[model samples]
Target: MRIGFGIDFHQLVEGRDLWIGGVKIPHHKGSLGHSDADVLLHAICDALLGALALGDIGMHFPNTDPAYKGIDSKILLQRTYELIKARNYRVVNVDSSICLEAPKIKKYSDQMRSIIAGILEITGQEVSVKATTTETMGFVGREEGLVAYATVLLEPVKVI
Candidate 1:
């Protein structure tokens, strides 16, 4: 099995929609970026790419490109998974964490897990999504931005 880790951060600003794990949560501030800026999904994409030593998300989908402007992060995740499949590898499991100061996500966790699992074509049990606060400490605690971390395990696809 191959293990890969990834982390992403995005500043929170007014006017943008808050999206995490493909779920749009009600919040006063949203992550700012070229795309929807779903931190969780971005981290997962990086982890999957890292597992295959294929570089990070920016390399594949550059923010400088207008094609990716205001794009949905879920589509990015799907394309990343396709890369994994092309290499004859399959995701074994994925564990991820989201750190933020406001708009508690406990109620949305299950939906997030389900969405991510569906994208990876894995069971919900195989995908873990956790959320936490920094206890009023840093950028996240100050509510300036949110961060997400993801680790993924992959194995070679078995041939019949």
Candidate 2:
């Protein structure tokens, strides 16, 4: 099995919609970026890419491209998975964490897991989503931003 890890961070700002793991959460501040800025999904994408040594999300989905402007991160995740499949690899499982200071996400984690699993065409049990707070410490604790980390295990596709 191949293992890969990734992390992403986004600044919090007013007016943008808060999206994490493809779920839009009610929050006063949202992650700012060229796309929807779903940190969880972005990290997952990077992890999948990294597993294949394909580079990070920015290289595939450059912010400089207008085509990705205001794009939904879920689409990015889908494309990333496609790349793995094309390389004859399949995701074994994925574990991820989200760190933020406000708008507690415990209640929304299940839905996030379900959505992520569906996108990856994997069982919900194969995907894990967790959330935590910074306990009033750094940028996240100050509610200035939110971050996410993801790790994935992949295996070569078995041929019949």
Candidate 3:
């Protein structure tokens, strides 16, 4: 078994759509980035990539490339899946957490899990998502941004 971890953060800015865990939640502001800027998905993608010792998301999907301009993060996730599979690694499970200050995410947790699990080709139960606030302490507490963390377990193609 192999383990990998990843974390991502995005600043909230006006005139953007709020997308979390593949679900669009009603909010006044959204994360700012070259892509849809789904922080949760970004973290998950990094985790998967890291598990294989390949690299992080930015290495494979650079923000400077127009090909990924305003791209859907799900597509990036799919491509990451292909890369890991090419190396004969299979995702066993994933766990993640989101830290934000507004617009609670409890209701969308299940949907996020389902979407991520489906993309990773694992059971929904194999993916878990949790949410929390920063208690108004720092950037997240001040509603300036949101961050997410993800960890994944993977198994090689064949056992010893």
TM-score of each: 0.99, 0.98, 0.97
For this target, which candidate reaches the highest lDDT against the unseen true structure? 1
Assess candidate 1 and give its lDDT.
0.97
Which pairs clash in model 3?
none
Please list the C-alpha lDDT of all candidates, in the order they appear: 0.97, 0.95, 0.92
lDDT of 3 by residue, 103-148 (tens): 8989889999999988999999999999999899999999999999
Q: In candidate 1, what are the lDDT values of residues 1-160, reduced to their tens digit?
A: 8898999999999999999999999999999999999999999999999999999999999999999999999999999999999999999999999999999999999999999999999999999999999999999999999999999999999989
TM-score order, best first, reads 1, 2, 3
Candidate 2 lDDT, 1-160, residue by residue in tens: 8898999999999998999999999999999999999999999999999999999999999999999999999999999999999999999899999999899898999999999999888999999998899899999999999999999999999989
Model 2 alpha-carbon miss at residue 77, Å? 0.3
Q: Model 2 segments beyond 4 Å from truth? A: none
Q: Which TM-score value belongs to model 1?
A: 0.99
Of candidate 2, the 10-residue stretch with the lowest lDDT total is 101-110
Give the local distance difference test score of model 2.
0.95
RMSD of each: 0.5, 0.6, 1.4
